[model samples]
Target chain A: MSDRDLIIDRYKDLLKTYLKGKSETALYKGQQFSRKLIEQQISPDDVLSDHVSVLHELFPDMSEELKDSFDFLLEVMIGYGFAYREHQSLRTRQRQLESEIEVAASMQQTLLMSDVPTVDGLDIGVKSVPAKKMNGDYFNFVKDHKSVSIAVADIIGKGIPAALCMSMIKYAMDSLPEQRMQPNLLLENLNRVVEQNVHPNMFITMLYGLYDTDLHEFYYAGAGHEPGFFYRASEDRFEDMFAKGLVLGVSRQTRYKEYQLRVNLGDMIILLSDGVTECRTSKGFIERDEIVDLIRAHMHKPAQEVVESVFNELERLQEFELRDDFTLIILKRKV
Target chain B: MNIQSCVEVCNEWDIVSARQLGRNMAKELGFGNVDQARITTAISELARNIYLYAGNGKICIEAAEKMGKRGLKIIATDNGPGIKDIRKVMEDGYTTSGGLGAGLPGVKRLMDEFMIDSVVGSGTEIIATKWLR
Candidate 1:
């Protein structure tokens, strides 16, 4: 090869390094070398052409094989760069979606969360877990002088629509006057609101209970929801607390029946979404007896610990991946 | 055509699944929306009966054809305490539990054929079949 060819080869090596490293020093040196090549009357395009020839010279026996090797490699690198750009954009989009869900979840959590009314003579504990980013389980506490009203509802569906319905329930509940002390009245009113506003396809199973400390009575109603458990300390037995009512949003005029329970000292009232009792075991689903047994074991603890222990035990039974929204509320009557 | 589906009716959520299974089978059997709705409602009542009385049970949904006409069949079985009086249960407003008492009679009215076999201590099995016109 001629002296000019050798110089062009050196430029090719330097330019490759400059492109690879994106090094400013390599770029500056390359600029200086290009200027020197210009000064010496050598063309830069000739150097690029010589780069291919250099490979050909190295593979003299395979000259024809190496002929378009550099161009092919450059083409492959350009395709790789396009794919890399696409990958980066996808990653960015994924991150944005994840963060958006996080924001929505937090916002929904705030909407679902309410101050557990610290009523006199009652220790209340509540917990909720969504199987997905959004939960359909709901619980609320509204208190007056004589009674603290509690509502635990599970939407018949999941995701955003259920979340929206839950908000509707909260507002409907707040719109009621204080005269709606009766659980049956509260549920009836709430059902009317749901039936009028929400889509017919969507429904809710709810249990509304108003515990009157003054009367030592707990008035409760159920709208096709799972029965809550009442632990009678005096009898050393469990009584299922349930009332007859259809699911909300089914009919506008549907009336819920109310039942009364005497909330005795040391007795416990537990309300849970079906997710708690329907926790999928290897067999299919956990039995209510198992749930009662677990609660009985933790009956000695505070309301908060009862919820925690029951949740932990149920989660263990299901291997920690809850497939539905879990909502539990425990109200303990202290002596 | 005999397409069948079996689901465990343990809780209220399972009752919903059982209802859906009945409707879906009806849909597959080419039943119209009204029939499908009736089948779903019947399944809901029956499934709730299993859940409320038995605590845990199973429901089988099947699509059947007889004399060149298609139909749907539902069989709900539970090991729960058997009903002492099947005839009384079929009477409207006869609820042993806290239910609305419209379940058994409502189910019987919804289907063309209904049969129940129950023993006091053993279990209860109710089968209902509806034929498409």
Candidate 2:
């Protein structure tokens, strides 16, 4: 037989073995055959034809079904080779998206206040849990020698956009002049800042308070925030501090309502986002009485314990996972 | 294919048992591997929602024959104050609390069928299903 015919005959035998189980050897032999054919100036089509003719001649006992199966295998191999490349590209894209999300979540963490500010005559504690990696709800406290300000705000949405809005709020709050001590003025200024920067569809609910230790007074304003709960230990009852206002970014002219309370000894002030009162329970829903009970049970404990107990009870009632972000801040006055 | 299963626990860590039960039900209903993952994620979302939002709630997994194929159903019922606005809850990025508001909406996107019934000052019931082809 001629050299070309010899090469084809050897390749056909290797192909049969490769199909049977010796895939590696078959692949090596096929590569060798192609290199030899290329050196001899043989076209790929001619090499394929020679391979088929040699296979038929050598396997005269092979059935038509076997020939069809070989053809199918060849098609599958070629298709799979392309599919493997496409799969790799898709995996790279998915990884890129995941990394982007991770970066966004990290940035969100920076936007949140890492530690509550320390101030005299105040025992303040705050806790937050994100349903996702990042949260749009945030609470921050800034204090100087004269006054202590506590700010709690919930951005209207979640994810990167809400996170961005949260950051904007934080920056604006940090940049505000110390003279902006009144909660209503602070909220009005924040509203203008948010309305100028945030998306029109998005809004924020904020509760800003300024407490003066020397004067023993607390002044607060609500910009569509939930009514905070005040446990006046002297009265042995919980009273709702209801202050109403339009949500920030809803309208530039929105008016925030300001309220004042005497900061008496042994009184506890609780400010929470919707995540607390909106908490669900197995029996049906969490009512104000249940919340009071939870507080009363742990009120005698440390401020941190009270915060943890509220979360613990909420977890017990749901007996499942949290659906939204949960944030709570507790401020207690020492007797 | 009427199939129902339930698990009860007092602690938050026990949530995993509930997740496994739901995943098993989805698998037994003939859901593919991908379908199983989706269902498991949805179940986790709802279960977490119950634990975090409602405090304590029951999870119910049911399988029914729908569109001539076995369908796995999950219902997370909670006596929480329920959602004040279903539309806002469904809206992407809209969260009453903080966090990335992806719980209910994420579950809605993952399942083949989704339904939410919530009454303010009442409770919330979420039903989601996936069909095995």
Candidate 3:
């Protein structure tokens, strides 16, 4: 065959591969071949002329009207190429995004699912569940020379924004000066940072407490967080260690007030987010007393068992679906 | 705001999670799309190292500030076998695990700050930071 026939043969193979796989790589290869054809000084009309001659040679009895449709075929192929390319890119972008969220969730899991610290005479058990891929609940522990600072923060929103808000809380808390390990002081510092960076509409409730191992004393503060429950094993009575303060990011000048608790042997300090206490019952929202009662029943069990039992109760109450992030932590001094 | 850090490691899932956390954070810090992609890629590389070399490790993603500039920081810590030759690993396309050999060196190029510490038998730690523009 002539040189022109060889060129058409190469073109035919390229088009066949593209049609078979519909791969972007193959499409671009076909494009490169077209470019080379042009560089050899072959015009589009000349290619068309050769195509027609080849068609006629193959189909000698073909009518003129049927022979002229290659132009229309070429036009359709061009449109298909653009649409197919766009669709492939979109699919790739979506896959990348899905994996990104998965990765973020994994990091959140690793961060939140850390092993509960094994203090010499204390038992710690915690559980957290996110209503979505991005959790709005966060818990962390910071240790000083003689004491440990524990914090549980809840962002008021859901999804990505809420998740990001939790990270902000973490960084701001991590950046605080060690000299200000007091609950109220740490909350105040975190408040300033959140108030500066976060929008007014989004607020965060946080409970921060410092436990002095030597003194067996716990100083805690609440920033519009849920009232903490403390069981007095001596009196067989439950005490609500609630403090007054505005939530973070609501006001720049808000100051959290700290409260003191002398943790005794077998005393349990239970902290939770609204997702647990606000679990809707048949009548309405479950009250704080129910959670306290449950903890009181499980007072003799391990800290982890208590948290697990409470979670099971919450899920039973909210059988439809969780509407918020769930977090529950129990710190018990076991003498 | 309340803040604290969590340190734990599981499997390759953690690596993917670290990369995603870094990418989302880069966006939250107002990083451009290009920078976000770069941060995600870098985290994946570092996290993959943890998965491949250490068997299991923890990856931490945090927002950091220096002077007035804000950025994202990622730390991958593992108790896996340490690299015998740091200089060789830093060279592109030099991998011991039959990987693309782009793990550490590519991560170094993608981030604004990169530091690594490793022992002979204890483990390896790679820390990378990318500042948002």
Candidate 4:
């Protein structure tokens, strides 16, 4: 025999030794089985006949029933191999999807204002949670010694585009000098910029406000934003500051409306995107009043706590994840 | 049935509701998932612009069959004030309010078709479409 044939014979002798007196025919059949046969490397018809004849030599009394058993084992092994290949493919696909989601989440995070600007006598806190890997809502605080600007805008849609738009809005706000303090003038300029550059159909609902810590006053402009809530600790009640304005990016000529409020000690200002009010409950949708009550319940808490409490309540009421991005900014004045 | 729907209002809370309703309508009409997301986002951006810059305006979401496929058309109209310069507004990184200035341009990218009509004093109307083929 050639050296290669000698190696095959030695491999068969080892198999026979391992199966001594324990079904020699089964061992011989298993040892001679070739996975390559099923893969069409060898003829399927000749594979079984040749392997069986080799096994019959090892066990002269071995029955045909034993040969059938060997065939079944080979079939099972092929099925297992196919299943393993499919499982490996699924695992690879899952890993790829996870990586994509991670990257998207990172991109979305970049759209948020990284740090809150510092202003005297003011405590501000902001929080945002996306329903998916990306968010459509954004908030930012821009400040100088004279005044602090707080902005909250919700892009009309979700995902990477919204995230990119959020970044654009942030960069625009960062480039604006303090001289552009007037909310209306600022929004007007922003409108022209967005209308000219943004997709013809995209727009933004924003509430931009400049708070003068020295004067204890807030100058605000609203463009398609929701009615903000102000809590008067002295009165122990909340009032809606429903300023009106147009959405951003519709027309270059559109004018924004401006409003003002005097900040007092122990007063709290709450700004939120539609996701807060539009959160759906098991029975139905969450009413605006319920959100107000939630704010009231956590009125005495810190600004951060107030924001977290509201989100917690929303989560408790809903069985499923929030359908939209949820964001909130709380501004509180200390005595 | 052939129908056209349009709304002109400030980009405010109510208008957002309008956009959401419009999105639902588009979905009911069997718009593709990707197309529906694009139209909804585009409409929201336009409505928001009307509220933010124009102070008040309106938006219209219309549906029609085009090329044997369902198509959604969105038009946002505002008379608040017209853009000073359309070219400047269309340019990226040029914002008056320190915002991203990405709203309009971003919407344009999301849609399959886009068009804009505006006058400095009159107002602006944007038309965009997503076809479910």
Q: Say which docking band candidate 4 falls in.
A: incorrect
Q: How well docked is model 4, in DockQ terms?
A: 0.01
Q: Which stretches of candidate 3 lie over 4 Å from their true place?
A: A1-96, A111-115, B1-133
At residue B9, what lDDT does model 3 achieve? 57
Ranking by TM-score: 1, 2, 4, 3
Q: Write the per-residue lDDT of candidate 3 for residues A113-133, one digit (tens) a residue.
A: 445676777899888888888
Winner on TM-score between 3 and 4 is 4
Docking category for candidate 3? incorrect
Put the candidates in lDDT order, highest first: 1, 3, 2, 4
- Model 2 lDDT at residue B112: 77
Candidate 4 Cα misplacement greater than 4 A, ranges:
A1-91, A178-180, B1-133
| Tens digit per residue, CA lDDT, model 4, A24-87 | 7766665465543334333332343344445767787887788667655544343233234334
Local distance difference test, each candidate: 0.81, 0.76, 0.77, 0.74
User: What DockQ would you assign to candidate 3?
Assistant: 0.01
Clashing pairs in 1: none
Candidate 4's displacement at residue A194, Å, is: 1.9
- CAPRI class assigned to model 2: incorrect
TM-score of each: 0.56, 0.55, 0.52, 0.54
